[model samples]
Each structure stands twice: as C-alpha cells, then as structure tokens.
Target: MTTKMVFAQPQPVLDARESDEWTSGICDCCDNKPQCCFAFWCCPCFACVKTRKYGQCLCLPLLDIFGPAHPATLAMRVSMRHRYGIKGTICKDCAIATFCTACAWCQMAREMDSRAIPIALVGTRPTQ
Candidate 1:
C-alpha cells in the first residue's frame, strides 16, 4: 500500500479596497420621476417593495418604525454595497440610513435597474 500526500495551493485574494462607485447619487431620485413620485407619495409602500426586492420578507421595512437608525435599512445598505463592490464605509451607510432612508432605497433600486439585475431574479437560482 502506498500513501500519497497532496498539497493545496492558496487562492489569490482580491483587494477589498478596490470598489466601484454607486450607479446613481442618493439624491438623484428625480432622474427616475415615476419611482421618485412613488417613493415620495408612499414611502412605507416603497420601502416595503424595496425590502421584498432585496429577497427579504415584505414586512421587513416595518422595522423602520423602530427608529431613525433602522436595522433592516442598515443591513440592506451594507449588503447592497458589499454585493455590488460599491465603495463605501459603515459610517456612510449609517448616515444614509439615518438621514436619507428613502433616497437611499431609491438609489439602490436605480442601481439594480441600471445593472439590469432583475428584481425577481435575485435570491433565485436555476434548477437543473
């Protein structure tokens, strides 16, 4: 009987500091007037839609009522930035969530739209 020892090579690590910029500015809601109006007319509804599109439960946006520093919003912001490799810091996420929650959501939605990432396709995988 012969025993063989195999060595595994280390995988290359990408630089986390190299990140892309956001597709749209937080306050660029006017760029998409319909979505801007929808978000403005019924922010809660817009938030709910955004939450559901994020692959979370539709009611997750209800967490916003807990306070200005909303957990759901912060989590979504952080995840979106990470997923898209967008350049941002936790402090920036906190500021956006605390002060510009609606605009932030709108910007995220716009970013996804610009990227052609179907809202229905997120969190879903093709089955063989």
Candidate 2:
C-alpha cells in the first residue's frame, strides 16, 4: 500500500474591496489643519519637510522651483499613488501638481500619516 500526503493552500479571509482612493481629497485641508497651515504659510519648506518624511532626500522638493512645472511635486504624487495603490492617472497628478501644488503636498502628507507607513530618519543608527 502507498500513501500520499496533500497540502492545502491558505486563502485570504476577507474579499472586501481594497480602497483604491486617497484617504482624503486634495482640497481636504481641514482634515489636517496644522499641515495645511504649514503648507499654506511656506509651501517650499512644507514640501521639503513632507518629502523628507516620505523617506526621500530633504532637498528633493526644492528642485520644483527651477522648472515652470512642478516636477518634484508631480513625481512625488505619482510615486505616492503607485506605492499606495491609489487609483489616479499621471495627467491628473500633473494637473494637480501644477494648479494645486500646496494642496497636493498637504494631501500627500495626510496620506502618509493615515497609512502609518514607517519612515527611517536620515543619519539615525538602528539600535540592536
């Protein structure tokens, strides 16, 4: 007599639809008042701070000033949408980055906060 063993694969417990949208609207500045105020008062600094929190170089957003179009903001928005699986297109991202740059940065910051994604601070050593 010969015996064979069978293994079962695990399946997801929930079939609930994953959210393919941003946690807050681009103009939902009231969702995060402090961040919105900061962005409103000094957009460049706010963008740089938010970019650093997103684990990129602290000065990455400053590059936006050199171009007529907000390249840094658009790139960051596209990257964030892709990373979070948010449903949006490049054209939309470009338009928002161009027309509502401050709001775009604020929305990105709120998304990062809501998702609770871990951020590694620069020059900080890990403890064993």
Tens-digit lDDT string for candidate 1 (1-119): 56555477445554343439998899999999999988878877998987787678999878888775777778888988888888899998988888888898899888767665322
Per residue, candidate 2 scores C-alpha lDDT tens digits across 1-128 of: 55554476444353333579999998899988988899999999999998998889999999999977999999999999988889999999999999999999999998888887444544634334
| Stretches of candidate 1 exceeding 4 Å from the true structure | 1-19, 118-128
Question: Per-candidate RMSD vs. true structure?
Answer: 7.7, 8.6
lDDT of 1: 0.80
lDDT of 1 at 40: 79
| Candidate models: Cα lDDT each | 0.80, 0.88
Residue 123 displacement (Å), model 2: 21
RMSD of 1: 7.7
Instruction: Record all residue pairs in model 1 with backbone atoms less than 3 Å apart, i.e. clashing.
Output: none
Model 2 error, position 59 (Å)? 0.3
Residue 36's lDDT in candidate 2: 89
Predicted structure 2: lDDT: 0.88
